[model samples]
Target: MMQTLPTLKKVTTTALVLLGLLTASCKTTPATQSPAQGALVSAQDSHIAYQGRIGHAGPDAAELYWSGTTIRLNFEGTTVKAWLKDESGDNYYNVIVDGDSLHLLRPDTTRRAYTLTYNLPEGKHTLELFKRTEYDRGKTQFYGFELGSDTKLLPPPAPQKRRIEFYGNSITAGYAVEDNSGKDQPDSTYTNHYLSYAALTARHFSAASHVICKSGIGVMVSWFPYTMPEIFDRLNPALPESKWDFTKYKPDIVVINLLQNDSWLVKRPEHDEFKRVFGTTPPSQEFIVNAYRSFVQQIRAKYPDAQIICMLGNMDITREGSPWPGYVQQAVAGMHDTKIHTLVVPYKNTPGHPDRQEQQQLANSLIRFIESNISW
Candidate 1:
């Protein structure tokens, strides 16, 4: 009787097992299921999703996006790979990843777009693509995460800070030059050139430098269609609605080079277009003097504690052209408690531009000036 009962129990167990197998055959792999909403690639778990934005202009503003997640970035490699478009030829960007100390990377080719790659550790990270220059008027480009591995990338410990701020026109911006190691020939404007005088000087003094300059822009004013009085309209337009908010970074030393651009408009011939733009009779030497004074005054208002060094005569001025040293002298004449210095460049490289030799010379002169005059 007991054996018969045991056999019955086995039969029931087998029937249930057969039913479970049939049910399993009706299901599919979870991987084949639809992607979850706002799903992103995660660095932590290979299965979890990530969300991040691409374009960043503020201390931590969104400039790019990939379903809204920050990507891990590093700088221990050569080429930085990014998925970007080539629609406009002038949309330039800078990369900031928490690397050795926040490495700012520039594109190496004219391929319209590229991707940046690096080996990083495992952890939460932030990748920011910042719009640096725009050649066209209304062309807009956005960048963020296109690709990365499943492993989380970790950032190194933050380094100590030594900061310096530089202000001027195109020259200070490394305009029309190549990378830091480019040959001495004029190519295109590369604000990435670290060999430029300002960068070199900053490196020599072991400090980090920030650039706040645009091509064809000056302080007391700018060229026609826009004058010194109209700069607030132009430079101020790039700024956000807040007063203390500007590109989100402040520097200790701000070396200004606006006089060169100002000199062109102020010293034009008696019947030149600049004279017409000002709606005044052609300016005498006195007009130039007064203009320089006003420019210095505006700079002082913006950066009160900054040690302002006014630069003149870059690669643009010819030997016989109007001397900027004299103009700078007049601007800082009555100012006190301020350490105002002047630099006169005697050589240039590009056609109407500074060559490598001249750049080295200018760098030497400026380093000496910085050491002797400004408190590094």
Candidate 2:
């Protein structure tokens, strides 16, 4: 029997949360240099900018679980500090300072303020903390930022005119993209969503983006208990009832890269998910095609005019002889919608999840596709 998930709640036993953080390895440590004296900015500060479907735990805390969730603030100061709480002590982040390349940061389970950046040149600077791990790693809370004396927070950065949202699996989440070992799976600390193709493509077009995806999820079934279709519109991934307000963030373009897991999972009749979804038999050609098409139609119903790109992988599912791309094609053809399109990133023959370099290559292919087709 499937276990019932609790309603997404704002509060939990602080002890268990703290214990989870305290249980991390001794190597996991927070930055020791906190601002001795300055203002403790509230997470509710108007000057701060946020992206992703974040849920709030309190008036001054933002709970973020999805990859690519970001909190940005501009301030003029010599030293900057931030207070972050890691739910499971497994999440990683990309600390992008002043739009620089990026510095990897792993916040310890501690609740104290961390000195994010300090001793910068005397001028205004931007600090963006980007979540690099998928939701399964656990939720993180953003308490606020702190700035030393003789500093003030600047106005929010200008919003991007272009907006894009991605729906995909491990590739889109940048899962294990940094690991090169031949292991079946690797640590979550190596995952970096900031370097994913979806993030790269959005940056190329200066589009604000939201990634609503989980690893192992497919349109029809997933390796886990839930599929993307059941969780796509949720504000809280674990809570089916915590629906996201689509009106708040409508994308000009939406990209759907699924079916990869289903392509392989459907063939495994003995797999638990397969047995639950299609007992004793594999999904037929028509069932598979219609399953994908129906999900796309669900998205269309939410965004009436957004261009939808039905994409396959840089994985085995997009191999030369793979029928996955054809399924997407047939689905789009059946939709009869001009805004809906299909494309496939050529298969990457690399082992495990595509490494960093391979992810860049996939991003380039997708960029080229969008350039050739979408005018934006």
Candidate 3:
């Protein structure tokens, strides 16, 4: 028998527990609850649909990297629990139950079962666990899900025909998008890549997206020790040898949102990244163009037929009169590839990362561009 769900104001035992900030639900099973009370489902089962660059940690565990890596499944039960592990223990996930994403789930650093929701009316329900943190937050291992006795996994959701890939930095990673206070500093608490222009744009097109991004990465340089070039082809950004097999998943459209970090770092030669990439002097326009051009060539080599959008912006880099967009245009022009075009979203102008509203604005722009130019 199921207990009655508590109203927003009602408090009750047997409550549903959400990760990170605790929220109450009726008959919520605690993470510390014994899994022996439920039936286990391996994450590798065909009924689970994972969309992103995922490698395997073990025979039963799925290794997740990148910002928008997602794990989705359908099941029959009154409750659901996810068994997951995080390297840094700082990652956040959007737990969508039956299409309603009212919970933000944060997994423990070590493997454990987290009750995503519980005590629901007995029936069918859909579960989508959308990763919200970027790779720097650290990798995660999904062991699978735990369901109530007599409940079983259902067929996975149909895959989307349109596949999209985004290579970018903080803006594309959706850093601070949830921080509307306009503070320039950001933390994982306010970062949500799913709300970023890249992921939102993919959702708009009903496309499956692979978001290869870091908060401070750039084409030529990055705030971190690595840059986009070093990790773009990697299945795990943390592992250099983990090269992604391009033949596995192909995107019909590719978007590159970068250069924002490079623009800022170059202005400060004293910064470690600037000194490492370009010591003592700022890189010339030709240098920037060539670097950008080389990265595009790499992408073109990997996805010969995929249309590439050499993008910049929604940052000060794309502010009026900035030469960054011109550099992107120059690089694309020299390549002379009709399939490759340049786009720069208007600078958000306000300080800090673009909030949810601002990200939506950027997504709206990209969606319109795709609608006007690309078909399919």
Best by TM-score: 3
Q: Model 1 Cα displacement at 305 (Å)? A: 1.5
Q: After superposition, how far is residue 364 of candidate 1 from its true place, in Å?
A: 2.8
lDDT of 3 at 214: 84
Question: What C-alpha lDDT values do all the predictions have?
Answer: 0.44, 0.80, 0.81
Q: Write the residue-wise lDDT of candidate 3 on 1-376 in tens digits.
A: 2222222221233335663221222232333333333556676666779999889986778998888998888877777777777899788887777765456677767566777777766777788888988887888998777776657666779999999999988888889887767785567878888789998899888899998888888888888778888989999888899899999899999999889988888899889888888889899999999999999999999999999998877879989999999999999999989999888899888877888888999999999898999887
lDDT by residue (tens digit), candidate 2, 1-376:
1112111221322111111112111121222322223666677767778999989887768889799999988887666667787888778777667786355566666675665565677888888888989998888888777666766677788888999999999989988876657563658866778879999999999999999988899999999998998999999797778889999999999999988899989989989999999999899999999999999999999999899999888999988999889989999999899999998888888667777888898889888988998887
Candidate 3 Cα outliers beyond 4 Å, as residue runs = 1-16, 19-38
Q: Could you tell me how far off, in angstroms, the CA of residue 311 lies in candidate 2 after the best superposition?
A: 0.6
Give lDDT tens digits, candidate 1, residues 241-358: 4132333334566666665666665555453455555556445556666776676666667667667777765655434555666766776775654555566665353553344455
Which has the higher lDDT value, candidate number 1 or candidate number 3?
A: 3
Task: Provide the lowest-lDDT 10-residue window in model 1.
Answer: 16-25
Ranking by TM-score: 3, 2, 1
Q: Give each model's clash number.
A: 32, 0, 6
TM-score per model over all chains:
0.60, 0.89, 0.89
Candidate numbers, best lDDT first, in rank order: 3, 2, 1
RMSD of 2: 9.1
